[model samples]
Target: MNALSIDIEVNEAHLRQQFEDCSDIVFRSFKLSDGAMLLLVYLDGLTHVQSVEDNILRPLLFNGLPQGEKPVPSLAERMKREWLPLANVQTVDSSDALVQHILRGSLGLLVNGEAAALIAQIPGFEERSIQEPKKEATLRGSKEGFVENLRTNTSLLRRRIIHEDLKMESFTIGSYTQTEVVLAYVKGLADENVLSEVRKKLGQIDMKGIIDSAYLEEWLEGSSYSIFSQIQNTERPDIVAASLLEGKVTLIANGSPFALILPITFWSGLQSADDYFERFVFVILTRAVRYAMTFISFALPAIYVALSTFHPEMVPANLMISIATARENSPFPTVIEVFIMMFIFDALQEAGVHLPNQLGPVGSIIGALVIGQAAVEAGIISTPIIIVISLTGIAAFTIPRYSATMPFRLTRYMILFITGFLGFVGFAYGIIFLLIHLVMLESFGTPFFRPVAPFDGRRIKDIFIRYPFWIKNGRNKKGGQQ
Candidate 1:
C-alpha cells in the first residue's frame, strides 16, 4: 500500500521517519556523473560496504548514467537491464518491500524521479563456519555438519543427495522471529498421505517464535502427550540424507543446527549412524549390547525390587546372602533404599550436566566416589543398591539418542513405583501397559512400533540388525518405492 513517490527527497524522508531511532540504518545520497540523483540505503553492520562499492558503485560510476530524458518507468527499466552489474538485483515499488529488502542486507538504490527502488544483494554477517557435528558424531561417515544458516544447511543436504526428485519446500513460521523452515524429501519415496499430514500440522503452528528444530518436533507430531519422540532429530547432514533416501521427511529450521527426521519408528531411536558404517556382524553385536543396556536401564531397579522383596529364592544363594548382609545394617526398606539411591544418582547426573564443562566430570566423579562410598560407609544405603543404581546410570549412556533415553528413565520410575506396591505382579503389569501404549502410538500417521509389533519379516532385517549392503533388499531407485 505504501507506494514510492517520484521525489527522491520524499522517499528518503519516509525511510528516515520509519527508522528514526535506529542509528545503524545508513542512507547515503550521491549524484551520478551526468547529475542524476540517487540514494543508497542499508543497515551498516549487516551489509558489506566493500562488495557494494566494487560491484554496484564502481560499475555505475565508470559506465556513466542512462542517457536521454525519459519517464521514471523507462529509466528504471534501463537501469535494471543495462546498469547494475550485481548478480542479484530486484526493483521494488512499495516502501514496505523496500524496507524488507534493506533489512535483509540488500543495498537499496532510489533514483531521483523513479517510483521504484533498486535492490542489490550483498548480505554480510558473521556466522559459524561448518564444523564436525558435536552431538551426533560418526566414526566412518562425513564429518561436515549443518550450520545455523538455512541456505548453508540446505546446501549440505543437497551435496550429499544430488537428484532431481530431492525436493525442498520452505515455509516462514514464527510471527516475531519469521524463522525459515524447510521440509525436504524425495518426491515419490515419501508417502503422499504422510506429506499431506505433515504440511497440515506445520500450517497449524502459530507460535510467536520457533527457536530450534525441537520446537517443531512436538508441535508437528500427532501425539504430543507421549513421552517418546515420534520424530528423530540429528545434526549430521548424512543422517538427513539417509533418512530422505528411506522415504522420510526432514525439517530444517533456521538458527538451529539440529534437523528433524519424521515418521521414524520407536526402534529408530535405538539405531545409530554407526550401525550402517560398521560390518554387519559387528553391528549386530553392538546393537544387541545397546538393546541390553536399554533394558537394564529401564528395568534393573524394578526387577531388583520385585525379586528381592517377593522372590528372594530367584537370586543365587551366595548373591542373596551377600545382598541380605549388605541390607542388614540399613534401616529403610528395600523400596525406600532404592528410591534414595536413585534420587541421589539423578541429582548428581543433573549437576554434572549443568555445571561448567571443566567441573562437570570432576563433580560427577566426586559425587559418585565420595558421596556414594560415604553413604555406604555410614550405612545410610546398602552397597548392593549403590551397585544397581550405578549400573542403571551407565546403561542409560549406551542409548544413542537422548529422546529414547528419556522414555527409558520415565518408564524406569513408573515400573519402580508399581513394583514397590505389588512386587513382581506390578512390574509385569507396568511393562504390559507400556507395551500397549507404545503399540497404539503413531508418528506422522505411521506406526510407532513398526516391523516388530506388526511382525513384518521382510522389513525386520534393518530393525534389530544391520544387514550388509550387498545382502540387503533393495528399494526402488525411483524414490525408494517398495
Candidate 2:
C-alpha cells in the first residue's frame, strides 16, 4: 500500500480503511489541473518509477484531461485507459480487488466521488533466466529448463505442446505466502480423478509457504514418512509433456527448478528420458543395467555378509579360500567391519554432494585412498570390503534420479542389519518388506508400482524394453483404462 494519493470523486476516508493496518503503505495528497481531483501510487517496486512519471504524473500535469471533462467515466475505467502504468487494475467496493492488486505486485489508486480506483499492473521481479536442466538432462531432447518465473515456465510448456487442449490451470496453495502454482495436462488424455486428487491434496497442505514443488508433491502423493519419493521430480519440459501425454499429471510451482510428475513408481524412477532417446536394444540394455545397479546398491552388502558369515560354502571353493585368507588378519567380525565400511562410504558420498565443487573430487579421492590404506593396514577391514563399498557407491550413482538412489541406500543398511542378525532370512525379509511398502504407496491415488503390480502386458512397451517406435504407437494404452 505504498501509493501517492489524491482522491478525485473517490472517498479518501474509506480508501484509508481499505489499507488500514498495512505499515509499508505511503500516500500523498495531490491535485489535477483546473481543480479536478487526482491520485497516484507507487507500491515499492510494484510500480516502475519511470512509468509513473511519464504515464501518470506527466499526463495529469501536462497532457490536458479529456480537455472538456464531462466527469471522466468511472474512477477505475478513467485510470485504466487514461493513466500510464496503472492500466490493468480492477476496482471493487469491499477492498478485495485493492488488496488482491497490492498482493499481486500492483499499486491501487483511489479517488473521491468515483466508486472505482485505478489498479495498475506493473510487476517488477527478480527471476533466473532459462538454463539447461541440471537434474533432468536428455541428449536428444529440448535443453530448455524450468525457471523461477511461473508464467515463463508455463509458456515453455505451451511452446512445446502447442495444443489448446493442453491446459494449464493455476491456483495459490499457501495461506500466507500466496505462492502461485500451475497444473498442466492434456485434456482428454489426463485422468480427471488424478488431477482432482492432486488439486485436493495441494489444497489440504497446512504449510505457510510453497517454495518448491517438492513441498506440494510431498503433501499430495504417498507417505511423507517413506524413503522413496513417490512423485518423480524432473526439470525437462519434454519429460513433463510426455508424462502429460501418457495421462500423468504435472505440477509446476513458482520458485522451483523441478516439476512434479505424479504416479511415479519404482519402475518409472528406474527409467530415464534418455531411455527413449536411444534405440530399443540399447535402451533395454541400459534399463537392465540400471535394474542390476538397483539390486547392487541395495542387496550387495547384505548378500556379501550372508555369504561370508553364515554360508561360507555358498561362495565358489577358490573364491572362498581367497576371501578367508584375506580376512585372516581382520580384527573385527565380518558384520562390524562391513557395517563400518558402508558407513564410511555413505559419509564420503554425502560429503561429496554437500562440499564445494572444487572439494568434491578431492573428498572422493581421500575417501578412496585414505580409508582403503588405513583399513587394510590396521586389519580392521579387509581390502575386499573397500571394493564392495566402492562398487555399491558406483551402483547407487547409476540411477538417473539422485533422490531415488536414497531409498536403495537405506535398503543397503537394512539388508546389512538383516544379514548381520539372521543371515539370508533377514535379507529376504527386508526385500519383501520393501516391496510391500512400495505396493502400499499410491501416487495421486494411482498404484506406485503400476504395470508390474497391475499386471498389464500392454503397458510393457513403455515399461520394460520399449518396443520400436513404429510398433509402440506412441501411447500408453493402460493409462486411460480403469
Candidate 3:
C-alpha cells in the first residue's frame, strides 16, 4: 500500500520506488521561497513539457508563496485554484489515485506537509488523424470516421447530434489495462431496461484485460453461442448516430475504431448507411439485391446438390445437358466437388483479407483463377461446382456488415452436408431449423429477426424495402417491436 501523507520526501521516495527503473518517468524537486520542498512527477511522452514548464513550473517558482507567509486555507486548494495555470486540475489523496492520474497523462504535484496531490491534465500523446471509414464506405454519407482515441470519438458523436438528451456513460474495465468503455444512447429514446442489462453484463466481465471493442462484444453478447452477429460493428460515426436515434445503444472502446451497436436485428445486416442517404427507390433496389445475394450465398450450394442428385426436372433441359457434360469427367461426387471448391475459395478469401493492402486483390484473383483452372483441367473438380462456389463467394460480399457474413459462410456448409444425404427434404429442414433458431435468439432483449418473426406491419416497412423518410418516422421508436 503506497500512501502519501504530510511528509513530501517520503511521498517522493515512495513514488520513485513504485516507478523504479522506468526511464520515461521525470521527477523534479524544488524549494519554495520559505524553504518548503515540492515535487513534480510525470511521464515524458504523455505529458506536455511546454505546458508544465510555462504554466505550472514558472508560475509556482516565480510567484510562489510570499517571503514569510504560509499557505492559507489548505495549500492543496490554493495551489489548485490560484497557482496552477492549467485548465484541468484535480486533488487526489490516495497514492493509487496519484498513480492512475500520472499514468493517464497528468502531472502530479506534491507539496510539503500536504497529504493530497494536485493532478494537472496536460495530455500530449500522438494520435492519428480521423480518416474515411475503411470497412463501411459510403457514397453519400459523412466521410469522417471514428479514430482510436476515446475523446475524439465522443467528439465526433457530439458533432452530429447536439441534443442535450444524448448521454455517454463511461467506465473503466480490464483490471490490468484499465481500458475506457463508453456506452452512448439518447435519453427517453433508449429503453431503461436494456441499459440496465448492458450495465449488468459489463459489470460481470471479470477479465484481466480488454484489448478492443471486439472483446466487449464477445463478453457481453457472445454467451448465446450463435454464429450470426448479435451486435453490429461500424467504423462510420453516422451509422452509430443513426442507431442511437433509433433507441439502440452503442459501445465504444478507447483504442478501437469500431463501435458495438446492440439490439441489432437480422434486418440490420441488409441495411446500409447509404440506404438513408440515397433516394428511396434506389435504396429499395439496392436492399433487394443484397437480400437476394444473402439468400444465394446461404443456399446456392445446397440447392445445386439437391437438384442434381434428386430433382433433375427442376433444372432446365439445356442447363442439365451442360452440367452433365461438365461433370462427366469429374471423379468425386457432387457434394465432394462442392466441398473442394468451397475450401479453396474460403482459403483465397482469408488470404485476401490477411495480405498487405496493395497485393490483396491481385493475390485473390491469381489464386482463384490458377487453382480453379487447374482443378478443372485435371478433372479434380467439375466446372459447374466451381461456378456455384464462386457465385456463393461473390454473394457473401453483398452484405453490408462483415460480421453478418459469418452466418452465411457457416450455414452454407451445414446446408450442403444435409442436402448431400437427404436430398431436397434435408435442405428444407435445414433452412426451417436455422430460421427457427434465429427467431428464438434475442439481442439485448430485442428480437433477433425483428418486425418479421412477430409480424409487425407498421414497423416492417424498412425490412424488405426502404420506405420514404417521412413514412418511416416513429417506426423504430419501439426498437423494431410491436
Candidate 4:
C-alpha cells in the first residue's frame, strides 16, 4: 500500500484540467482521414509551430490512413517509412508518453481506439545571444559572456573546443520547474573518476526549481556550510572552454548566465581573466599586489589590536602616546572598537552593492567623509583606526574573485578575537587552523590548496609569479596536464 499508484483512467480532459494553470501548454485536436482522432499538446517556448504543421500535421492529414485499415500497423509503418531524420514519433499506450513528450518540448498526438498517442519529439527554441561578463570583465580579453540558454551556450562551447571528442549530455531536472541542465566535457581529456563523480552529484539533486547555476552549485557541491566555493562558477564562455580543456566538467543550466566549473582550487580563485591577456611580468606584479592586499585585508586590524594592548613595544615611541590618549576617553576595548568599525565598513559595502548606481556614490561619500571624519572629531575613535579600516576595505577589492575574498574577511575576525585573548600566540593558532581547514577541503576531487600542499615546483612557477608566455611552456587546454 506504500507504493505510489498511477491514475490511468484519467482522461485528457482531467489531465488538462490539472495543468490548466500552466500558460505554456497548447492543446489542439487533429482529426485525420478514416475517422482517426488525435489530440496534440506542446509547450509554447520549447516546440516550434512550423515543425508541428509541416512534418507532423500536413503529412498525417493527407497521408494518414485508408478507410478499412487497422490502426497500429498502418500508423507504425507510416512513421517508420515517411518521416526522414527530423520527425521522431513514438507510440504510447498509457498517459506517461504524453506527459513526458509535453515536458520534453514535444507535440503529443492522441488517437481514438489506438490504445496510444503518437509522441513527436521536436524541440526548437529561440535562444538569446551571449552577454558581456559583469564581475570578471577584462579590458584586453574577449567580452562575450554566456546567456540564459543551454543550446546557445553549448554551441559556444562547440565553437571553442571544435574537437570530435567534446561531448554533451542533456537532462531535465526539477519536478515542477523542469529546468534544462547540460553536462559538458571533452571525452578523452576528462578523467573517468571525476566525470563519474560529476554525474553522480548531479543525479542526487532533487529539488523544486533551479533558478540559476548558483543554485545547482549549492545543491551539488560537497559541503553545505563551507565558506569557499568548491564548484567554480563563471559567466564567460571562454572561461568555460578553458576549464573544459583543463579536464574540468561544466554544468550549464537553462536560466543561468553563469556556468559551473569543477575542480577549482584557491589559486584558481586568485586568477583573473586578464592574466593570460597581459604580459607575464605585469601579471606577476599584479598577482603579488593582490596577495599583499589579501594579507593586509586580513591582518591589519589584528595587528592594531595586538599593538594597542599586548605588543606596545612594536609601535614607534612617538606614535604610542597619541594612540593611548585617543583611547583614554573611549569606553569600549580596542578589540571591540575594531570589530565595530569593521562591521560598519562591511555594511557600507553591502549597501553600496544593493543601492541604485546613482545612490552608490553618495553612500560612499557619506561613509568616507561623514562617518570617519565625524567619528574622529567627536573623539569616539582614533584617526589611525579610521585609516586602518579604509586600507582594509581597499585591500579586499584587489582580490579578483569576490567569494575568495570572503574567507579573508571572515578570518580577519578570528585574528582579531585571538589577538585580543592570547595576543600573538592566539593569532598564530588561528592561522594554523585556517591552513589545516583549507588542506582538508577538496575541489571536485582536486586538492583545494594545490601546488602548495603537494609541493610541486613546476606548478609553483605560475602560482606566485606569472612567467613569460614562452616560459609558460604549455597551456593545459586540457585541465590536469598543466
* TM-scores of the models, in the order given: 0.93, 0.89, 0.95, 0.85
Candidates in order have lDDT scores of: 0.87, 0.77, 0.88, 0.79
What is the C-alpha lDDT profile of model 2 across 1-482, one tens digit per residue? Answer: 33333444345555557667866555655666666665554466555667666666677777545433556566555555555444565665545556666666776666555555666776665568888887776777778988878888888888888889998888887877788888888999989888877777777778888888878866875588888787888888888888888788888998887888887777887888888888888888888888888889888888888998899888999988988999999889888988898888888878988899899979977887887898799888997788788888888888888878888888788779977999999888988998888888877677788778876777766777877765677545454322
Per-residue CA lDDT of candidate 3, range 1-482, in tens?
55678999889888988899999999999997767788999999999898889877887788784322444666667765664565588888889889988988899988898888888889988999999988888888799999999999999999999999999999899888899999999999999999999999998998898889989988888445888778889899999999999999999999999999998998898788888999999887888889899999989999999999889899999999999999999899998889888888989999999999999999999999999999999998988898899899999999887878888899999999999999999999999999998899889888888789878998898888888765677545445632
By TM-score, who's the top model here? Answer: 3
- lDDT-based ranking: 3, 1, 4, 2
Candidate 2 residue 423 Cα shift, in angstroms, is: 1.4
Q: Clashing residue pairs, candidate 1?
A: none
Best candidate (score: lDDT):
3
Worst 10 residues of 2 by lDDT: 1-10
For candidate 3, the 10 contiguous residues with the lowest summed lDDT are 65-74
* Per-residue lDDT of 203 in model 1: 97
Can you rank all candidates by TM-score, best first? 3, 1, 2, 4
Question: What lDDT would candidate 3 get against the real structure?
Answer: 0.88
lDDT of 1 by residue, 397-429 (tens): 998876678888888889999999999899999
lDDT of 4 by residue, 1-482 (tens): 11111322334675587467998888777677776776667888889889888877887789774323445454445564556376776766556546766877877665554555566778877776666787788878788888887777888889888899998988778887888899998988888888898788788889998888888888877866777778888888898898888788889999888888887887888888888889887888899998888889999998888888889998998799988887787777888888888998988888887889899868976987788888777777777788889999999999887767887888898788988998878888888888898888887778888889867887788889988655666655444345
Each candidate's number of clashing pairs is 0, 11, 0, 6
In angstroms, give how far residue 459 of model 4 lies from its true place.
Answer: 1.3
